[model samples]
Target chain A: MKVLSRLLQIREASILLFIFLFVGCIGIVNPAFTSGDSLGLILKSSMILLVLAVGQSFVLLTANIDVSVGSTMGLSAAVCGILLSHGVSGYLAVGAALVIGLCIGAANGLGVSFFRIPSIIMTLGTLGIVRGYMLFYTEGRWIEDIPHYFKELSAAAFLGIQLPVWIGGIAAVLAFIFLSRFSVGRYFYAVGDNEAGARLIGLPVRFITVLAFTFSGLSASIAACLFVMNIGFVPNQTGSGIELQVIAAAVLGGVSLSGGQGSLFGAALGAIFLEVINHSLVFLKVPAYWNNAISGFLLLLIVTGDSRFQLWLKGNGKKKKQEQEDMNRSKLPKSGEDGYEDKVVL
Target chain B: MKIKWFYRWEFFLLLLFIVEIAIFGWISPGFLHVNNLLFSMNDFMFISIAAIPMTLVIISGGIDVSIGSIMGLCSIILGVSWSHGVNVWLAVIIAIFCGLAAGLFNGLIILYSRVQPLVVTLGSMFLFSGLALVISGGSKASGYEGISGFPDAFVQLGNGSFLGVPNPVWFLFVMTAAFCTLLHFMKYGRSVYLVGINSKAALYSGLRIKWISLSTYILSGLGGGLSGILLTSYFSSARADLGSEAVLPVITAVVLGGTSIIGGRGSIAGTVLASIVIGFMQYGLQAIGLTSEQASIVIGAMLILSVMARQSSFQKVMQWFRQRKSNSSDLMY
Candidate 1:
């Protein structure tokens, strides 16, 4: 029971357990779903979302959002696909896509940090512009018959894991390290957790904030490359609506939209959970249409449950001190000797 | 200097609107006719409808992305129920109820959990649209094949006109008046502004913050419901994707109308006028042989430019006016 409570306390643990139970239930309904090979298929399919979520975690950690990511991926993949189809070398194609991502991400960062535009509107405008640019550049044409080498690279397996899976793993691992290791890494949480305090402490809050956006762009571009490689084609609607998926994954992994909480591993786990749910919909022979509703429902349940659990643990059941907490949250700390700073010492 | 006229939002927007009409008429001689203009005006009002309530929501320091999903869900409910032998009016009412429930759920969650409104609404955006799909019998019955065979009275509600004005345009006018009055003239209006400007202060001032917040969302839901029903009538069918394209335009209208995204300051009048401007601009661009997708690019540019204009300080403009005045005086000397 102690272990059970411990498992429940960590969002990642609970999400993992939930994923397995869901899969297991579907297996009961259809025995073939629990097979080892199908489980590998699930992991393989989740790789793109996992990579995107890892990137999104960096921005969410800084209390900002990048809604332009979906279009960024689309644009980058289009550019790369066009370039590769033109017989450009693979390295050059990759370099060009990364450059495009950097410029766009830098623009997003500057718009939010310098112009003081809200991140959502800034990125939303960018989302439209980037997608428009892609359409115009590609002339709304699909780039098919991508080079055979590129397709093979994406599909090639190592130690039973596909290339995209390995890339996603490296990304997750790298995100965890970058967020946990460097001193600047810790600044993201500080700035996001308490911006004014971080400023008062003489941190390069602007630099860190800009860096998060850049990292988000870089991650999305990487995902774009994987996308182009995996599917070996670039359609007009490529990467459409991916921002919501990446965001949902990050949120499911316990990353607070308010920022300063959650881990990349939890986000990766969330990607897996979402992907598995998608897979289970097939296994259960649920109408092909109910897939979206189920995931959306699960997204609500998890977030709502997590919040209620936090409130319950705080011993302030519904109604009691609710207004008091509101007042406290809105108010600034009275002086320098604040205890809230110590709470994030990890 | 006549620069003072520019400082009045209504005067500025009205002047701009007139100038815009003249310019469009100049560009396309066919644009000046009333029948042509009013015909297109029918499709434009629902955008105004959604933006009207959204103005109140933004003025209260929150947003409702889920309104789009609410519209979709309501449309689906009306369609599915009507196809199953229900009276169209009754089905519309049921659709409105679903909107209210969805909106109420959003308010309750945000109120109890104290989460950010954007994330909450974003989550529900997906949830409601997905539910709409399920109710429409999933992909098997979906993919642009909307439910049809509506009663003639309901069809007239979408198509018929009053005194040469489109019914949708009339609905827009009435809703705008009602909401503008509620937002600008009533005591509740003051509470909404007070809550948005400083929520903590509002709470301490004996205002019911919970109820006020909840009311904004409920009212926004009703706005979405009204638009959904109109959309069903307009097309004489209903689908799960109703109002999906309206999210960005609604947000754009609210912000471009001089509403601060951070909340506290907004005007219903500005939002209505801005929606008109945007709706016309979309039509105008398409009239010039630009595809709707290309026109979307232009609108996207307008959205960013409007927000950037609002974010910049008016001090610069004021300084320019002062400098011009001083230079004129020096020339007089």
Candidate 2:
């Protein structure tokens, strides 16, 4: 019962419950949505976002944001796609893309941590610079004609599930283990919870911040690779506006924007939930144009509801603790009298 | 004479402006013409207008990314109402009210929900833009088929000159003066800075933190609304995506003008000067045949570089370089 209560108290449990309720409601509205095929499609479509959200959760865990992730994804995919079209080796192109992503991420981290620029502003600047440069480099054109073998990688199935889903799932599981079980990984939480206290405790706060961003960039690159494979081409506008979705996904998964709270699993689930919403809208025959507005409304509603629920829980806990204290005080006098009566009888 | 004007960031910005003008003039002689300078103000007028309130928002330690979308929404509102036979002027007023309401929504959500301003504004950004698209009928045709054919007077409001200066230049000056007085000379302005510097302390000391923060967002919304209306008139068309591209440059202007994103330190003068510098830079770059995308790369780099240059760490690194130079000279001697 205690374990069950503790599990129920976790933010991930609530997110899971919300997802189940949402899926059930959608299923009731359109029975087709509940089918194994449609559900699998939803998970497949969410793989890229799931990968990006896990990376984002790292920076969020450290109380910093990386708005450049979307652009990073775009630039890397552009490079990777262009390379493949030019008949370059697949592994080489992928490595180059990863390196580019890492460098951009490191630059963001350096600007925010070393130069002391605000992470949001720093990343915003990079977002523009990177996007603009990519456009300029490509001359505002798309990179098409990617190699066939590379494109086939996304569709290849493993154990009856698609490759992208397996990759996203593995990334989330690995990140969950690293974050929860590793001592060094705990530094991100500590730094985010209280920077001054973390520094006072002799933690490398700046380095940890940089590491988190680097990991975020690395993940964006991985997502970019998947994007190239899945889409088979890179548009100049690749990953544009996707930062909003990734951030929304992380936040929906109960990752506090203020930082120091959330998990990789929750973020991944949030990604899947967002994808499901997108697909469900189609299944429900909603206009495609309404997607943006509906998603925005849902984000606001969920966040407001979650915050209100947290406040109520806090208030209830305080009241319960007060009652417990009052009960203890009343029982203390009776216990004292019983001890005295026992002594007299003796 | 007692003031060390050289030490101020605004002074540095002025110097940068002079340097930019000299360089641009050398590259394109026509760029130095007064008429050209005033005419080019039309290109970035919306950005400057929005940056004015954005200055206040940043000074209060909050950000409103939704302002750009608010501009779009207000523009659509003005267009739809005017087409529906309402007086164009009344439509503008109604549009401004919509902007205010959107801002109020943002302020209330951030205040009551205790969510970070960034997240709340991000959500609203999409919401406002989506509404704009919806109200405009979500047609790809709307790209070029936006509402047009406004009355001559309304069109003249955006393009006409007064006293040999463009109307936009005048608007910029007036708005700058009004906000300058509000930010630098008013008691309410002091409370904004106080709240931004330390909200907890400000609250304990009897400051109305909520009102101060909320008012900044309202003003920002008003600025967005005004930007949308002017943009509509300038182009003689109203589209759902009118100021969608303004967010980057507007923020660059405010941050470049020395408004710390962390809040509690900024100036209106700096923002105006910085916007002018940036506006001219873009104009000059385009005059020299650079694409808009290339210009964006320059602006983005400039934003990051300027901020990095302002950091104490950068200064320390410079000092260390100087020391190394001096120490190496001594060893050689």
Candidate 3:
């Protein structure tokens, strides 16, 4: 019963458990799916998504979203690629990417904070605008000729793990500490939980909101650097259709669409889970096109289950409240002592 | 009269429309030619036609991002039906029904499941796109090759002009007028506005908020279907990717026209004028040295700048400057 209660408490964790069990079942059916190289490749591929999800978790915690992260990554990578091709040092190229990403993020923050536009609409608009800028800047051409050192940073391994996996691990650790141990992190939850309450308490809501987006931007720049290093070429379709994947990862990780909940650890694990499932499908000889259908099916199942679980929780909360009310009623005296008892109860 | 003047975003749109024509006419010598002007209007007709119901949907406190995919799906269905030797008119009706069905799915999930409209529409956007790709087998359908013998009357709907103006433009004008009249003059229209402003309040007042939202989505679906049919006829080809790029442009037209994204306050007249403004801007910029891709930068900048100009921060800054100047003058005195 305790285990059941605990399972109910962490519904997303249970979902993750079910996913792993399913993956394990698949592995038992196809032993080849458990190979080291396959696992390594999946983790490496998930690194960018992991980074993106972490960044998005911050924004979502503040009741905002960064739908343009994918495009911003593409644009940043394109910037990096352009500079590196022109003989800029790798560090300098990365710095430039971060600065450009910061500018874009600042623009999104300003739009939402000052313009009073909803984050969803603002980000959606920038998704196109940023992608358009990237296209115009690169003239729809692929950026080839990335330096070998940068490529190694993306693909190379340490202690039998790829660099990106290690980077993702470090990022997750840092994010966990920052969110759990810091006052600023508590402020984010406060703001997302009840904006009017936070404002009444005198929290710097706008600055924190902007800071969340800046973190999102910085993370996207990092992901872009990792992405360009891995692919060695930046195409116009580099991050095409990635917004869905980022949102899916965050949602599957237990991030509430309405905001104020979720963890970076859950987001990373969700990214890993998604990437592994994708790899497993390929390993199991599923057709590439069927992947979308499968993911869509899984997404539907997960979201419906989550929503049902939420409904159950709400019902339980209501029942508990009603029970408490009944208990209070039963303890009350009949008519004559009502006034004295009411005063005592109050 | 004073109340009307104060509430005249639509009138402002008209003034901008006149200014656009004058500016474009002066910039490009050929802009004044009747044929060029007619052709430009024709080029913009499809987007404007599609923006009609979208305007209503936005004002009804919901959004439909899947219109582009619905348009593509409808076009594909129309082409497939035509290729199967069905009558063109019946095929068009079937295509419109397909669009309606897709939109119904969106409305049901959003209303019944209590999902956020943004998330639901985002999911449906991909769902419809995937469905289109799967049904079409990821290939373009050149039904013009097989249906080359379209009836002259059907062809004239796309190609022929009336009274020296293109038929497409006339269709757009009629549809816009009809929608404007419906949105402004009808009780249902007022209900839509009230619902958008406050759903709970509307419900308290005995309005069917869900039905209002659902019907607007259906209307958007129909609008998308009409745009698809027109586009398939105009380009004489149908593909799964036909209207994919129209999503951003249509939303931009709606938002740039000064319609509140949060819903309740907007004007179809504003949307019409905004479409014209965007159309002229695109054409005029293209007429200059800017490539189509570069023109996106300008459009993007304008969107950001317009929103920024509406910020309270700007107003605060202006007030601060005024206060500072006044204080300094008093000290000097």
Task: Name the candidate that leads on TM-score.
Answer: 2
Listed in order, each prediction's TM-score against the native is 0.90, 0.91, 0.86
Q: What is the C-alpha RMSD of each candidate to the true structure, in Å?
A: 5.0, 8.8, 7.5
Residue pairs in steric clash, candidate 2? none
Residue B34 lDDT in candidate 1: 84
- Candidate order by lDDT, decreasing, is 2, 1, 3
Report the Cα lDDT for residue B148, model 3.
40
lDDT of each: 0.82, 0.85, 0.76
Cα deviation of B65 in candidate 1 (Å)? Answer: 1.6
Angstrom error at residue A12, model 3:
3.1
Among residues 3 or more apart in sequence or in different chains, the pairs in candidate 1 whose N, CA or C atoms overlap within 3 Å are: none
Error of 1 at A52 (Å): 1.8
Of models 2 and 3, which has the larger TM-score? 2
By the DockQ metric, which is better: model 1 or model 2? 1
Off by over 4 Å in 2: A1-8, A320-346, B138-145, B313-333
